[model samples]
Target: MGIDGGIGRLPLAVADAVRTGGGEIRTGAPVRELRRTADGWTVVTDGEVLRADAVVVAAPAPAAARLLAADSPAASAELATVDYASMALITMAFRRDDVASLADGSGFLVPPVDGRTIKAATFSSRKWGWLRDAAPDLFVLRTSIGRFEDEEHLKRDDADLVGMSLADLGAATGLDARPVATRVSRWDGGLPQYPVGHLERVARIRAEVAKLPGLRVCGAVYDGVGIPACIGSARTAADELLTATLAAGAVGGERE
Candidate 1:
C-alpha cells in the first residue's frame, strides 16, 4: 500500500515525532565513517564525530559499504556486490475531461518483450481516492521508464524523457492530449537488484553486521525495496537492538 496524499510529508512527520519525544534533529551531518568505541560507536561526519549508544546503517548499498569498510570488510564486500537500477517518472496532469474515458482503469504495466519504453503507468488520480478528491479538475497520471539493464534512455534530458513517455503512452492507451502541468523526477541507482542466492547474501551481511555489539543494518538493500518492507526491516532491527541493549545493561547491573 502507498502513503495517502503522498510521502512528501513523511520527513516532517518523523521530525515532529522526534521533537515531541525530546530528540534533537541534526541536519547537514554527512557521515563519513563508523567507528566502534569502547562505550558504543562513534559516528564520523563531515562536521563532527558523535557518540551513540547504538547505530543503524540504513544507507544505500554502496554508501553502506563505504561506512562499514573498516569495521567489517566481509559485509562491505557483500554490500559491494549489490547492483542498483535507475528510473525516471513522468508525472503529468491533464484536464479531467480530456482523458476521462481512457483512465477508467488503474493503468497497465508494459511487457518488456513488447519492446516498449515505458515499464509501467499509474493513473494517480483514479487509483488514489485522496488525490482525486484533492484535485478533481485535474487528471494526474505517471509513467515510469527504465529498468535494471535498460537505462540508456534515462540519460536523455527531461524533455526527451517526457516525450518518450508520451509516445509510449499514446501507443498503449491512445492518450493524445497535452498535460497542463508536467514534472519529471529521476531516481538514479534507486533500486537494488536481487539475483540468485539473494537471501543467503543478506544473511551473510546481517551476520557480519551482528559481530559489532551495538551495530545493525537495515534498508532496501537488505530487504525488499518497497516502503513497507524497508519499514518492517527497520522495526525488526530496532527491536533486536533494544533487546540486546537491555540484556547488556542487566548483565552490567549484576556485575556491579
Candidate 2:
C-alpha cells in the first residue's frame, strides 16, 4: 500500500472524509459511560450526551472495560485482563555528510539477546519516498525502545535516549554521526500483547458483549493490532450493528 506523506496523514484524511460526509468528529472528549435506554443508547461524554441507535466502544481494552463495566460486567472483567506493552520511538535526523557509512537497507532490528536499549530501528528516509524527497540532505532514522514489561528504559530523558540510540546505531552501522534534529515519541500501553489464551479470552469477551443490545466493542483488544486489522475489525463491528438494527426494525414493523 502507498503511504501518503506519513502514517499520521492517513488518519487525518479519514477524519476529513468523515467531516465532509457530515459526520461529527470529536477529539479529546472522553466518554464517561454507555447507558442503554428505552429509545436507543446514551453515550455520556465529558461534554455532552449523544443518543444513538447503536454504540461502538472502539477504545483500548482497559478503557473499554471501564465503559462496559455497568452494562456488561462479564465483558468488562474479561477485557480488563488483556495485557499491553509500552514503547518509545526516538527519531533522529542527521546531516547526510556527517554519517560516514549509512546502511544499504531500511535499517535493522536489534534482537533482545543483543543487550541493546533499542529493539528496532527504521531508516525513514530510505523506506519512505516522501521523506527522502522532503529532505534530501538529511538522513532520518527512528529507533524503538521498550517491550513487554520493559519499562525501565523509557525513564531516560530524551537526550539520553537519543544518545543511546546513536551509540547503538554507530555500533551496528559504523556511522558515528551527530543528529541535526531529534524527536522522542512515547506510547504508553500502545501495543496489546496477545498471549497464549488471548483468542479464547477475546471470544469470551465478545460473547458476553453480544448479550448486551445496542452495545459493541472493537479495537486492538479483540483483533490484530496493525492498522489494517483494526480497520477490518471496525468494519465487522459496524456491519454487525447495522444488521442487528435492521433485523430489530423488521420485527417491530411486523408487530406494528
Candidate 3:
C-alpha cells in the first residue's frame, strides 16, 4: 500500500476501531496522588484508591514534577527541568467558494523565515480521509501560533489569533472567507523541546527512577513527543514493570 493509504488518519481511526472492539473510555476522573507501599504502590484518585504492582506516570513534565515531588523528590527535581512551549491551534472551516487558490493536499509548514504572526497551516480535510469525507463542501484550515521564540504572541486574544491565522491564510491561499465555524485550542505548555543534552538528562532521570522499585514513568516528555513514540515508551515501561515484579516475586519465593 502507498504511504498515505497505510498511515492516513491512523491514530483516530485506530481508536475508533478499538471502540468497536469494546474498548471503554473514562473521563472526568483525575489521579490525586501516588504512594509507594510495602506491597506495591497505591494510586489515589478523587473517588477511589487502588493498588498496583507498578506505576508509569505519563503526564507532562511540570505535572509529573508536582506528582513526584513528595515521594520521589529526585525524580521530580529532574522532571522540573524539562520545558515546554506554549502554543495555540485555530481550526477554521470555510466554504470552498469563499476560499481561493487553496490546494487540496498536505498543509504548508512555515519556516521561521516566514516572519509571520501565525506559524503554519494544515489542510486537515485534504490530508486525511475521515475528515475529508465529513465536509465535502468545506475546507478545514488549522493554523498554529506561539513558539519559544514567539512567546509574546501567546498572550494575544482570540480575535488576534484569528486575525493572524486569517492573514496568513489569505496571503498563502488567497482565502478571504469568514469561517463558518472556528475552534481555538490553547496548550499551556506545548510540546517539550529536546534541547542540547536532553538525552543525557533523560538518561539520568531514568536511572534515578529505576532505583525506586515499583515506579516508572512514560510520557511525551520522557522518550519522545510523537504518538508512536509515546505508545512505544508506554509499552517499554509495561515490560519493565512486569520484569521487576517477576524478579521481586522470585526474591520473595527464595525468602519463603
Clashing pairs in 3: none
lDDT pick, better of 2 and 3: 2
- The list of candidate 3 runs beyond 4 A from truth reads 1-26, 103-105, 250-256
lDDT of 3 by residue, 1-256 (tens): 2234335468668678779998543457677787777776777778878776777887888878887887888888989998788899999898867765676567888888878877788877677766657777887779999887577888888878998899887888777779998988898787898999998988988888888887788989877888778988988887998898897783321111
Better of 2 and 3 by TM-score: 2
Ranking by lDDT: 1, 2, 3
The TM-scores of all predictions, comma-separated, are 0.94, 0.94, 0.83
Candidates, ranked, TM-score: 2, 1, 3
Would you list the C-alpha lDDT of every candidate in the order shown? 0.89, 0.86, 0.79
Ten-residue region with minimum lDDT total, candidate 1? 247-256
Cα error, candidate 1, residue 163 (Å): 1.0
lDDT leader: 1
Shift in Å, residue 238, candidate 2: 0.4
lDDT per residue, candidate 1, 1-256, as tens digits?
5567698778688899989998777787878988887768888888776777788888999999999999899999999999999999999999999996694689899989999889999999888888999999999999999999999999899998888889999998898988998999999999999999999999999999999998899999978998788988999998998899898883321100
What tens-digit string does per-residue lDDT give for candidate 2 at 1-256? 5585888888899999999998778899999988777756778887787778888889998899899888789999998888899999999999977764786899899888899989999998889889989999998999999999877989888999999998898888898878989999999999999999998998899899888776678877878998988998888888998899898883321100
